[model samples]
Target: METAGLVLAAGEGKRYGMPKALAKHGDRLLVQHAAETLRAAGCERRIVVLGAAADEVRAAAPDLPETVVNPDWATGMASSLKAGLAALAGTPAIAAVILLVDMPGVTAEAVRRILGHAARDALVMGGYGDRRGHPVLLGRDHWDGVARTATGDRGARDYLRTHDVRVVPVGDVADDHDIDTR
Candidate 1:
């Protein structure tokens, strides 16, 4: 099975006073941490959905698998997601494993686990303590649905509600941790 990794690094980080992707957490930027986690999970192809400080954030991951700039990032996470989905449109054999640049707490093991079961449904998310969060895995079948997502506060949660999901529960704390300071 083919799989692709997508990182959402387009946020303006209004509350963090800088691009969220460039924020420092530990010794690395949040987006770098996230991209590293995804890359470690054995994803052959990677894509970054960038906006705001697109150039700066893209440059941060010089060896990143690939990069896709999301000009509609001003619209919000939904736009970034759709942008990533569009980039994956040509790769029908690969699943898109998405990560949030701000949520650096999500571990690589969790992402591997999610990808391990991607074929179960169109969408598979890492669940922790009753809440499912990112590093969400989407099989090739859902690419069209995700790419067609509309503007104004759209996201995978709404689409998942209409389909069956393979929810993998994690006993870890990353599920409840909200990285956004705002």
Candidate 2:
């Protein structure tokens, strides 16, 4: 099955003091790192959602994958997630693996593992050891509802809570920590 990669990079990052997408992880910008990880995972197409400092981010990573600006980004993550999903409309992608811009610990391996578990009717959640986390795989079947439920900083969390999500262990290949806090 075909899958696309959605990198959520539209947050204001008030907690991190600036746009987390521009934050550096080692030598690469956070957005660049996230986008590269998604590409390395074999996503047929990658969509990045930018809000805060969108122009600066674009300039910083000129080679970044297809990107869209979320004008309602200040509203929260939901808008960005929705924007990313909308950008995938009418595509051949049977699923989308979501990656957060601030999460540098997520590896291509983890994303591939999640992609490997894609089902037309199921949601796959990447797990680090016993903890479920990012690089989530949302089957096309769940996209509409997931987008509808995405609100605030919740994204699909509310929908996932009310549904059955398959967890795939990927700790050996990735870390599930968020670089949001200073």
Which of the numbered candidates is closest to the native, going by highest lDDT?
A: 2
Q: Which residue segments of model 2 deviate by more than 4 Å?
A: none
Predicted structure with the largest TM-score when compared to the true one: 2
Task: Residues 1-182, candidate 2: write the lDDT tens digits.
Answer: 67999999998899899999888888989999999999898986999999989999999889898999999999999999899989988898888899999888899999988898887687999887778899898889998999888999899999998999999998888888888786
Task: List the candidates' TM-scores in order.
Answer: 0.90, 0.96
- Give the distance in Å from residue 40's predicted Cα in candidate 1 to where it truly belongs: 1.0
State the C-alpha lDDT per candidate. 0.77, 0.90
* Model 1 lDDT per residue over 1-182, tens place: 77888888888988878888878878877777777888888877778788898888767756555778888888888888888888878775457888888777788888888878766245888887666777688887787776665455456777777777878875463543646673
Candidate 1 Cα misplacement greater than 4 A, ranges: 173-176
What RMSD value applies to candidate 1? 2.0
